[model samples]
Target: MSEVKKIATRASYGSALVELGKEHDDLVVLDADLAAATQTGMFKKEFPDRHIDCGIAECNMVGIGAGLATTGKVPFVSTFAMFAAGRAYEQLRNSVAYPHLNVKVGATHGGISVGEDGATHQCCEDFALMRAIPGMVVMSPADDIEAKAMVKAAYEYVGPVYMRFGRLAVPVINDRPDYKFEMGKGIVLREGKDVTIVANGLCVAASLEAAEKLAADGIDAKVINIHTIKPLDEDLIVTAAKETGKVVTVEEHSVIGGLGGAVCECLSEKAPVPVKRIGVNDVFGESGPAVALLEKYGLDAEGIYKQVKEFV
Candidate 1:
C-alpha cells in the first residue's frame, strides 16, 4: 500500500495566500511578527510590498487589517491562534466583525496539537469565541486540499472569517475527483447505519480511521466532515443524526463550545439524539510531544476508536 501524504494546514494557508495573491492584486497579508511560524512568510516572500509585519501586536494588527479592508483590500491577518483569536478578541469583535469587514484571520497552531507550546499557546476556545460574533464565519479545514479551498472561499465570501490551522501534518483524505468545497456544508465521507461521527480539522481523519476500526468490530459508523463551524451544516448534521439515532463529535479542541458543543447544540434542537463529544475535557494541556498529547487526550485514531467502541 502507498503511504498517505501529509501536510500541515498552516502550510496550505500560506500556499493558498500566495496563489490568491497572484490572482488578486488587492489581496494583502499582515502578521504579528509570526510570519515564519504562521507560514505567512510565503506570501511575504512573493509580495514583500503587500505583506505587513505588525511586530507582535495582535490587536493592532487586526485593526490595521480592518483599516486596509475599508480600502477595498482583502487582508488576511496571520498569527498563532492564541494571539489571533485570544489576544485580539476585542479588536476582532469590534473593528472587524462589528463593521463586517473583509478581513480574514489566519489562526495557525490551534488546539492541543500545538504540542510543546503548552496551554498558553494552544487555543481550543477560538471556535466558541469566533462563533459568538454575529456575522463571523468560522472554519477549520481537515486537510491541505480543504484548507486551500477554504481560503479561496473565505476570500470570495466578503466578510469576517476566522480560519483555524494546525501545526501537525495531517493525512490528505479529500483528494478524490468527486470532492467539492462549499461554505456552510458538511461532507459525508462514509455511509453507515450505525452511529454518526462528525468532525473537523485533524479529527476528521482520525474519526475516519476510527470508523474503519468500528467497521472491523461490526459497527458500521458514518463519518461527516464539518469544516465550517459558525454557519454550521445543521441540515446535514440533523439528517445524519436522524439516520443514525446516535452521534459522536470529535475535535482537537476542548469539548466545550467547539465542534462537539456545536453538534450538541444542533442535535438538541433539531434531531435530539444521544451524543458523545470526544476532545480535550475542559482541562489545560501540558507540554508534551504533539502525537503523545493527542494520544493522551484521546484525539488520535486509536484513542477515538477506543472511545467510540466504549460508546457503542
Candidate 2:
C-alpha cells in the first residue's frame, strides 16, 4: 500500500466533471454562484460554454438543470447541500425526481464538516431530505477515488441522482486499484466477527481506524463502507447483522434519519441486532474547525473507537 493523500470530495467531483465533459459534449453544469466553493470552477474553466452560473438561486438552478435534462442534455447541478437539498428541495422533487430527469445533483459541504459555516450552512438532514424523494439515487462517497468514480457513474445513470461531497479533506480510504465503485453496493474494508461498523462519507475512514484500534483489544470489528444511502445494500447489512450479532452505524449527519436510521430500518425487519449509532444526536452544529467539529460531535476516529468499544 502507498501513502494516502487527503483531498476534498468536491475537488475530486470537479476534476471528474472536467474529464467527463471532454468525453460527453452534452454534459452541462449548473452552479448557484458557488463554482469555486463547490469546486465546479475546474469544469467551467475547461468548458465555459457548457457551465451555467445561476447566481445564488438554487431553486432556479435545479429547474434549469431539469429543463436541460428534458432537452437531452446531462446537467450536473452544483451547490451547497444546505441549499441544494433544503432550498431547492421542491424543485428537485417535482422537476427532477418526479419527471425522472437525467440530472445529477452535486451537493457539496454536506453535514457538520462545513466547519466555520455554522449551523445555517451545516446541512445535517440532507440525506433524509434527498432520500425521501422518489426515484432519487442518493450517494455519499468516502474518499477521492469513490467520489470521482461516482461522478461518472451518476452522469451515466439515466435518472435523478444526488451525491454528497464534503468540505473537509478526508483520508483516502478506497485507494486499492482493484476497488470498484458500484451504486447500491457496500464494500467491506475489514472483516471481523464481533461487530459490524457500517459507515459512509468521512465516517468510513474513521470506522476503518476504529476497527484497527478495536483489534488491539481483541474485539474484531468489520468495517463496511456504504457510499450509497438510498437503495442501500440491504444484503450486506443483513449478512453483517446475522454474522456479527451487533452493529454500529457512523456518519457525520444527524442520528435520527441518516445512515444509522437507514441501517436500523433494514436490520429491524430482516435481521434484528443491537445497533449503536454514532453521529450528531439530534442537534445543530456550531462554528469550529473541521477536525475540531468532527471530534466535538463524536464523528472522528477516536470518537468512533470509544463508541464501538462501549457498544461491544
Candidate 3:
C-alpha cells in the first residue's frame, strides 16, 4: 500500500486561503500578531494588499474584521483558538454571529496540540463557546482534506463560521474532496453493530485507529467523523444509536462541553444508549508534545480503545 501524505489542517487552511484570495478579489485575510504562526504568511506573501495584521488584539481584530465584512468583503480572521473564541467572544456574538456577517474565523492551535505552549494556548473550551453562539457555524475538521473542504464550504454558506484546527500533522484521512460536505451532517467512516464511536477534529483519527484495535478484539466499532458540532448531525447520531446500542465519543477537547456533550445531548432524549466519553477530563493542559498531552488527557487511541472495551 502507498503511504498516505500527512497534512496539518493549519497548513491546508493557509493554502486554501491563498487560493480563495486569488480567486475572489473581495476576499481579505486578517491576523492578530501571529500571522506567520497561523499560516497567514501565505496570504501576506502573495497578496500583501489584502492581508491585514492587527497585532495582539484579538477583540479589536474581530471587530475590524466584522466591519470589513459588512463592507461586502469576506474577511477571514486567523488567530489562536483560545483568543479567537474567548477573547473576541463579544464581537463574535454581536458584531458577527448575531448580525450574520460574512466573516470566517479560522482558529488554529486548538485543543492540546499547541504543544509546548501549555494551557494558555490550548483551546479545550472553544467548541462549547462557539456552539453556544446562535447563527455561528462551528466546524472542526478531522484532517487536511476536510479542513480545505470546510473552509470552502464556509465561504459559500454566507454567515459567521468558526473553524477550529490544530497545529500537529496527524494521519491524512479522507483525501477525497468530492465527498458531499453539507453543514450539520456527520460523515460515517465505519459501520458496525456492537458500538458507535463519534469523534471530530484530531480525535477522529484516533477513534478510527481505536476502532481497528477493537475489531481485533471481536468488537465492531463504528466511527463517525463529527465535523460540525453546533448544528449537529442529530439524525445520523440517532441512527447510529438505533443500529448499535453502545456509543463512545472522542475529541481533543474537554469532556465537559465539547463534542461528547453534543452527542450526549442528542442521545439523552432521542436514542438513549450506553455512552462512554473520551476526552480531556476537565483540566488544564501542561507543556509537552502533542501526543503526550493526548494520553495525559485520556484522549489518545489507547484511551479510546480502553473505554470502548469496558463498555463492550
Per-residue accuracy of model 3 over 1-312 as CA lDDT, tens digit each? 127677789998999898888788988999998977899899899999999999999999999999999899999999999999999999999999888899999999998988899988888999999989988889999888888888888888899999998898878888665566777899999889999999999888888888899999999998999999989999999999999998888888888888899999999999999888887887888899988888877678888888889978
* TM-score of candidate 1 on Cα atoms, chains taken together: 0.99
Mark the 10 consecutive residues where model 2 has the least summed lDDT: 1-10
What lDDT tens digits, residue by residue, belong to model 2 across residues 214-277?
9999999999999999989999999989999999999989998888899999999999889999
Q: For each candidate, C-alpha RMSD in Å?
A: 1.0, 1.3, 1.5
Q: Which candidate, 1 or 3, has the higher lDDT?
A: 1
Give residue 21's lDDT in candidate 3 (0 to 100). Answer: 81
- Clashes (backbone N, CA, C under 3 Å), per candidate, total 0, 0, 0
Stretches of candidate 1 off by over 4 Å are none
Order of quality (lDDT) = 1, 2, 3
Per-residue lDDT of candidate 1, residues 1-312 (tens digit): 128999999999999999999999999999989899989999999999999999979999999999999999999999999998899999999999999999999999999999999999998889988998899999999999999999999999989999999999999999999999999999999998889999999999999998998999999999999999989999999999999999999998888998889899988898899999998898988899999999999999999999988998
- What TM-score quantifies how close candidate 3 is to the native fold? 0.97
Task: Give residue 146's error in model 1 in angstroms.
Answer: 0.4
* Winner on lDDT (2 vs 3): 2
By lDDT, the best candidate is 1
